[model samples]
Target chain A: MEVMIMKRAIGVLDSGVGGLTVVKELMRQLPKEEIIYIGDTERCPYGPRPHDEIEAYTWELIEFLLSKNVKMIVIACNTATAVVLKEARKRLNIPVIGVIDPGARAAVKGTRNKHIGVIGTKMTIESNSYETALRHVAGEIDVYSLACPPFVPLVEAGELDGERVRAIVAETIRPLQSSEMDTLILGCTHYPLLAPVIQDVVGPDVHLISSGDETALEVAAILDFKELENDLDTVPAHQFYATGDVVIFDRLATEWLGQPVRAEKVEVSGVDA
Target chain B: MEVMIMKRAIGVLDSGVGGLTVVKELMRQLPKEEIIYIGDTERCPYGPRPHDEIEAYTWELIEFLLSKNVKMIVIACNTATAVVLKEARKRLNIPVIGVIDPGARAAVKGTRNKHIGVIGTKMTIESNSYETALRHVAGEIDVYSLACPPFVPLVEAGELDGERVRAIVAETIRPLQSSEMDTLILGCTHYPLLAPVIQDVVGPDVHLISSGDETALEVAAILDFKELENDLDTVPAHQFYATGDVVIFDRLATEWLGQPVRAEKVEVSGVDA
Candidate 1:
């Protein structure tokens, strides 16, 4: 029972495996803390989904995580975050965090040219959440945003490397080449996995801000501030859950996490209560 | 009267103008927010002071800031923060931010080599706060710490340029020369003003993490997270206060802050009922 009390994991919700980047960072930054991740991979890519449906799915993920008695809630998916984060923050009792704000703050601080480029899914870009977060930090900041529709699908499919993928990435992000942005924000969590290719296209001059790394740091800050850190020094057996095929989820989870992981298949239909 | 509610400035307290680095970053990051800075310049170097005395002076600064009804409190001084931040965060009603944790988290995340260097006042280095913070973030990390007593006094005297200061900085930080720390946390907020010189000494390969920039980013994160941001769009009339000579404080403030300003003298004897 004492061990159970110390085992309440940080609940992480994402549309799919893209949030692995955040998980990777969270593990690296706060190694002692346990994480329970819920990936709504059945309805993967919440970007094109309607706002109402997105919110419902997000709540389902939140509810599942909460049932396990999570200490905090992290909206690791940009599309889900853009849709449900504000409402979830108000509605939930636990401290709620989103990927957008951290990335925004980082881009604002890291940019030398005062001009930033952001690439995300259609919903994330259309929401203009990054622009809002960036402008909220510094008024004089210039933001250039693009929605890379093919990017997420490519990541989810594990088409992350090779000349074909590089060509696709180049053509997809070709519009922002002339924007003269010194800093580029990997607004979508999935983008980091494709970073080597993206860096190849964008060149070394443009700094890439990973939302996962930034958000993980923010989580550490909030945990410390709130005095909600799990004090157990013992390593935790981290858990991963998926709403779709368990085999693929496990494979990718193991690959991205750089460790062996077994993903449990979960049904995220409607709310339990 | 409506404007009065929104005009509550972020109260920033430093031993002296060393924290002006934090204030400068805060203003740049959160431009719309009002700021009220109090520099305890009379007892400028809080490094050599006793713990009990430092705590008392910190409380005095907090009381003065509270009297003005500050929206947030930032302990921008390294020595004071090393001594008083934990207690202040627990005692204060509003959010209280410190310079150390932000730098710690940034260093942990920024370091690829896992070997980091930290430089600060004697008191801050003695506290081993950075080691505690760095170890807290990730285990099996190497940390090299040094106390450069002259850096603060040099910064206070505005010896920010030329070969003399550079030689002093190089000689002072000479102990950590071959440590091979890829990331260096300018653990003292005063250190950033001497960055060019420090960068020359440490070499460009060593990434210097300024507490001010990282702390400013944390302040923004906390403000947005806690819903403590000031919403007014119009410019705010920022105020400056000094416990000692207003002339030197005003001059240094203007030089470091890049704006002309006047500093008012204030007495912080004891707590007000």
Candidate 2:
């Protein structure tokens, strides 16, 4: 009998260590498939960056992943996903995904009052990516968007839980308390690391939608629909890269992922755009 | 300014009123898209029928929906989906969806122990569709499938909640209790109507993966990816058809859907297979 080799890995890129939330879920949800992830921790918060700058950085990451011969690409950063998702899909041969849409879809399904809340980086909220995405597939939705800038920094520092985190979450999330939103989309990837704190602040009645978790489900759906899933029997070797502090990323990856992962440093400028 | 015309409706077919569960979700999640649903309530339980007969009946339903000029199609009946899904995709021009994969994907996502339980019609369980779909995406998954042949009749009889239904569900779902499955997929489309009882039987720790709700989310994701979603300003004009007892189907549709809907009768033989 002839042998059938395994297919190519899926490429995932993000602004920083946040995308590991997506990676963890992918590992759990689609264990057979291999994944390659790159986080630009050096230029970490893509949220405050200009549109052109964000797209240019995103395209470079795409090219590097393309060179690795990935079968599909997932823009795991909500900020970048909002800025460059449409263009990347048009430019690339592979199917490209955004974190925004999956969370939006899940929020639509989970909500009973059609009232949704979104908390993300300033750029993600200002771009109205969650609102646009939520309204694109769903109709007549009441969207309440808030920008939570401190959440990412907390995760990057490997500070997931404590009184400090809870106090910050309670104060920051207080604005949306009166919205009466039943489903809150954690629009930023790093937000999931603080999900328990966020969920606590939002109360038990409100469901928190994690972009990382929901995107993993969407990735599985796309693979099945496109017939691009890997049917390999070999153990998957997941690769992780960070542009800034590999030490910090490595520690957080191991801690958050519940597995040991060594992150390598990569210079974003060295990759061909 | 140029106006954009609305897209065509999505065609959905099932073995009987069980598929209305899917329709209810589609309405809730995707309020913009028009839906055309047909149920072969005459030959209601496709679960007991041979594969060849299921395919023939499904093809006739597909042809009727095609005549209405739908943009996409969904096989809402788990039994028919398992039998006809692959062949139908190969023959159809538009994207065709099945109820099994979505539930399988969700179960894989929701399960914490990598152990899952599936409860479906006899044919769906016997076909090993859930196991196939689950293992196809994720590796090393333990799936326990039970053929709850009595559950469908309970839903069809419109006896959703009562002590009698609770006793039947508790008895039928007892096999899965020993499986140590963290996620239990209601593999039959009709199962969602009976979800409260099933959940009570299985307990709260086990996450119930409703095929109808999951498929609705998948439908939204596919629509966004394919750009087949409707962007019309007009309210959707939904249509319902049944090959058997229109009155019974109509009553179930309105009651389960929580909306007043009139189902029309059609002769399945008149439609070309």
Candidate 3:
């Protein structure tokens, strides 16, 4: 039997285009690693879906990337990562990393007052996944979690900041402000995109941790530890695939990635598997 | 035969606390009416969820409100309104109203340039419901729909205007600005909260429509037609319920509603039925 070598491509999947946030950070942190991204725009906002459904959808994306023979898998979407990471790691041949643990670790490390705030999709918050992760490391630390449900949609629509976004920021986060937290975890991948707005709302004293950046660092460490770092001579390129409109994926990718992206359309089915 | 008089509250539900936005408008539009508002804080960001799940969840909320004997239902969430309004109307005994059609009607009536821009959740943009509503009323007009996914999270996190939110806004709406659209529709109920940021991003030529406010008008009209409008003689009271933390809800409600709101925690079950 011939052995297959893992390719340099780092596979990333989100319920939709928000995973580009991780891709954005991955590009900055690991410049030599090519990224193969799959955004399931066809059925996104995995936040509210039943656990079984989310698990299935996430696995489908993972299988697609695995079929490409990617070196590793990154569950970029917070909801998917929160709900399915363990199962994914168990099933995948290569290392499967998620955003929650890295983000929780960073928040734990960064907090000075022992008061840390966490924000993400409603389902993520409802699951208390971050609280669990934070408690696992530092049980006595105070973890405040709020679900900023509409945030991903706002980011996707491109209304990042303004009076409307500000008001919503004020409304959504008023809960955290009263708690007097010193550091806040930007738990959702889409949140870093709204860092300025969130920072302003939480004020200067609160430190905002972008899980995207932290997760990228985690990816780097895992790659180095496993001797899986892509060779430097290769020019890293990013390819985007979506089940939705290619024009939308391309526009969003270009806007998010800071470079022109041509997303190819893929016909994917058989997932009632 | 005995005739019984019953007191019924108007039901309003949003993906999250942003429906306080509709509450604000409702307070202004129908000061004497009692509002029974349900915000699905535990499972929000309905914009990105699958159509079936969104419909099921929205119906769940509707069923919950119906159990409360609500005279009318206001779907203050954009995604919920977009994906489930007709079905909701068909299923419920009370009058069901959504934000999009009312907002689209207002945009059609408000625009002088005949070119309108609509922004909301990804589901809202994908549905083209706003465009469909606008075109149905005025066949020759041009409509542009932009999906601003991150806006809600930014606003919920309390960042209205900041460098990060601005950069994201600039990047997302730049293409629309170049296209020369004059009137903009805040298609999402949560969007009006980000109106200032959107105005700054899109510039002054574009008029912003608050779908929340328009929906409030629809509520008022329906109330008047049905003779369900509350009398202004007594002090108006608004009741807020959340499946999540009451303190978080109260804090956000007070901030968004301007007046102090003491939200009460309520058990919500049988939403899917």
Per-candidate local distance difference test: 0.89, 0.88, 0.78
Superposed Cα deviation of residue A236, candidate 2 (Å)? 0.9
- Give candidate 1 regions above 4 Å deviation: A1-6, A270-273, B1-6, B270-273
lDDT of 3 by residue, A20-132 (tens): 88898787656667899999887776777788898888888988898888889999988898878877766667888888877776665557677889998888899899998
lDDT of 1 by residue, B28-88 (tens): 8788889999999887777777888888998889999999999899999988888889898
Give DockQ for candidates 1 onward, in order.
0.72, 0.84, 0.01
Candidate order by DockQ, decreasing, is: 2, 1, 3
Q: Is candidate 1 or candidate 3 better by lDDT?
A: 1
Candidate 2: list runs displaced more than 4 Å. Answer: A1-6, A270-273, B1-6, B270-273
In terms of DockQ, the best-performing candidate is: 2
Q: Is the docking of candidate 1 incorrect, acceptable, medium or high quality?
A: medium
- TM-score-best of 1 and 3: 1
Global local distance difference test of model 1: 0.89
Clashing residue pairs in candidate 1, if any?
none
Determine the backbone clash count of candidate 3.
35
Q: List, residue by residue over A146-257, the lDDT tens digit for candidate 2.
A: 9987887787677889999999989999899999899999988888878898888888999989988899999999988887888888888999888888988888889888
